[model samples]
Target: MDLHEISEKLQAGAAKAVAALVQQALDEGYPAQKILEEGLLDGMNVIGEKFKNNEIYVPEVLIAARAMNKGAEVLKPHLAAEGVKATGKVCIGTVQGDLHDIGKNLVKMMMEGKGLEVVDLGVDVAPSTYVQCAIEQNCSMICCSALLTTTMGVMADVVKAVEEAGIHDKVKIMIGGAPVTQHYCDQIGADFYAADATTAAEIAVDYCAKVANG
Candidate 1:
């Protein structure tokens, strides 16, 4: 199937159909990056907008994200095998004291769909874990999500840890969650705050591009 046909199937939330179209495109000699941008990313853009508008809820979003994920999986190995690097690398976590992961997982999926290499530190991640992962992974950005007001305070601690470890200037920091606000992100020294997954992916890819060009 063609990229346009694949993207339409994705918008309709047909996971297996989309995945097969991705494989078909790859088998027909389409570049992985082309399929990614015109197909998977385009589909996610629609899904993200629907989610923001409340026209689609979590279950539907999850299914679409899962389809996008399968497409990402099929393309990833080819991109690597062909020596094509990802746009950027990121370390993402739910922050220490936050056991919930739904929000973080969504952001991670969106980031991955945008062709980012994400090192997910999982839920209940410590400040040191984030800092260490950023250092070891050479991540261009570090993302933190906290679902509760109480756990959100840990964002400052994670930022502080990055500063103390002397890697603060080396990486951009991002924060999000239900209670996270732009004001809170600025107060906690985060470089970016995303109200949703699409904005988060946009911020990450844009930041990486700015630095790479500089």
Candidate 2:
């Protein structure tokens, strides 16, 4: 049976439909990994692209992500039983003193949609928290989000923390937010800077794939 319907329903933000279809696909003996990749991730990738291209907005991405989450819930146990590992692991959070979380949440959803295991540290996260979580979780990347200029400086502090922890070579750093730019990313020595959620997820996936292959 074609799993494209699962992708279509997910893109349409039909959460219950996506979940039910995922169960059906499993009952039909399709591999959980295939359903996740070809069905859920495929739909999310389209949504991400549309979001990046200005064809869709935040609300749409949120709903689609919700649908993806619903479908992923159905596949999670089966995936574990199949020994399907995540593409990569990354920790994400908003910087200290910043109560903003919408951007961080969006990046988390996009990363999850790409099959990356994300550890969300939530808003108002201290630099040391990022460093500790990366070490504890064995995360390959640390993604920092900050909407406030004052708080954005904490991202640089996170870089410093990682360097001071002596894990700079082990973990890549990605930074983004309204006030963050490639210039700021360069100035802070972050490994990647994304203009939007889609680009962030793309950068993360590419980085993780390279790390995996190497």
Candidate 3:
């Protein structure tokens, strides 16, 4: 099976085709990890780059993500049987008092595209919840999003909670959203800040790689 075909169809956002192709690849005896990395993730990397360059928009990213998800569903059991592991784990949520989730959802998709297991905590998540989930899930990263200035302060509280939990050295904190900036990230002592979802995924991948190597 030409995994490249699967990658191309996935990039074109053909969910059904991607799913069918993934099954065909498995039938052809391709490794599940190969299909996941070279087919689905390869396609999503292209979409993420296009999005970051402004060559594509949200709808395109969404469709491509859907395609990736479809392919992944077909490959999931095989991947598990093969003992394929995600690059890293992260728990993400919108801060307390913030109901906006579009940005948070995008980041989750983008992270998953990069082969990171993302645990989405949904909207209006409290600071303590972020810390609790990170500890419970054994996540390497905690990502917080806030679209409102009022809610942005909650991110700082999250950082404090992580510190209070004495897991500050084990888990990294990342903050982002419409109201967030690099300065704010610095002020709040977050380990990383991304202006967009694509960048967020990249940052996560890089950090996970470093941790794995060390």
Q: How many clashes show up per model?
A: 0, 0, 0
Regions more than 4 Å wrong, model 2: none
Candidate 3: give the clashing pairs. Answer: none
lDDT of 1 at 130: 90
Runs of candidate 1 with Cα error greater than 4 angstroms are: none
The digit string of per-residue lDDT tens for model 3 on 53-137 reads 9999999899999999999999999999999999999999999999999999999999999999999999999989998999999
What range of 10 consecutive residues in model 1 has the weakest lDDT sum? 1-10
TM-score of each: 0.92, 0.98, 0.98
Residue-by-residue lDDT tens digits, candidate 2, 1-214: 6899999999999999999999999999999999999999999999999999999999999999999999999999999999999999999999999999999999999999999999999999999999999999999999999999888999989999999999999899999999999999999999999999999999999999998998
Q: After superposition, how far is residue 9 of candidate 3 from its true place, in Å?
A: 0.9
Q: Sorted on lDDT, highest at the top, how do the candidates line up?
A: 2, 3, 1
RMSD for each of the candidates: 1.6, 0.7, 0.8
Give Cα-based local distance difference scores for all models.
Answer: 0.87, 0.95, 0.94
Candidate 1 similarity to native, TM-score: 0.92
Better of 1 and 2 by lDDT: 2
Candidate 3 residue runs with Cα over 4 Å from true position: none
